[model samples]
Target: MIDRADFLARFGGVFEHSPFIAERALDVGAVALPLTAAGVHAALVAVFRKASEAEQLGVLRAHPDLAGRLAIAGELTEDSRNEQAGAGLDRLSPAEHARFTELNTAYTEKFGFPFIIAVKGLTKDDILAAFEARIGNTATAEFETAKTQVERIALLRLTAALPGE
Candidate 1:
């Protein structure tokens, strides 16, 4: 078991820059002291579900573009950096980096936010393929799709942060 402060401190970065999810979960008693990743995720989802569309969009936008500016500038959150590296985003050849930049620009220009995917098990090719496929989706559909991907990312991060998985 842990205190609220400890819980927030540990899991604050789980949702990129959205620590309010943790705080809200605690306030609603959705998170028990000795948290399981699933419980925490559910609580965060509950909060997300109740949020206004604008708020949800803000959360989605909070996430960095994969291998985008933040990564190049060394400004990504530790979790994001590690996740990108895990998917081989950190070691992209020159052509690969340019392709990612192009796709990222196109996706953001189209949807008004970064293209997101939970890259835990995916390769660079997989991420690129997803970017290609998802860019064709309508804005409404892409908004929903991005939110779903954020949930998947939160779950993966929560699981990794849990004491025993």
Candidate 2:
């Protein structure tokens, strides 16, 4: 029930948590020695204080496996982009599954990370097609692509967390 003005004033600079959430997260992170879920909630509450639901999901949507096209190889992992995209296309209609299977293997071989994308709104075929198209991209190109995807995810999470945001 904290006011937006008060919350924003206290914490307004963060790369990850947006302005308000980041500040509270920092405060809670600074002193969670008591170790309670409430402490965690306090930190998260700051994130949600002024955000929309989509923004909140943005932070969690990131794909951890994709590498930054321009990022050091060291930064690459198994899941880099926001893994979620459109929701509920699990039972891919035959050809869709095959495409995903091929793309998944090819992408993993090329970049060493799962081709990640937000799948909340897209179909499995679409996600697989992106992977296929991206498989043809150069490492540097893919790295930048992944970075952009990550930013999108973060923004989504941020918007969701803000109270009236």
Best lDDT among the predictions, by candidate number: 1
lDDT of 1 at 7: 84
Give the TM-score of each candidate.
Answer: 0.94, 0.46
* Model 2 per-residue lDDT tens digits across residues 87-146: 333345557556656666677678655565654466655665677688899977776575
Report backbone clashes per prediction: 0, 46
Q: Could you say which candidate leads in TM-score?
A: 1
Candidate 1: list runs displaced more than 4 Å: 163-165
Q: Model 2, poorest ten-residue lDDT window?
A: 76-85
Candidate 2 is scored at a TM of 0.46
Error of 2 at 11 (Å): 14
Supply the TM-score for candidate 1.
Answer: 0.94
- Across residues 50-126, which tens digit of lDDT does each residue of candidate 1 receive? 87898888888999998999999999998899999999999999999999999999999999989999999999999
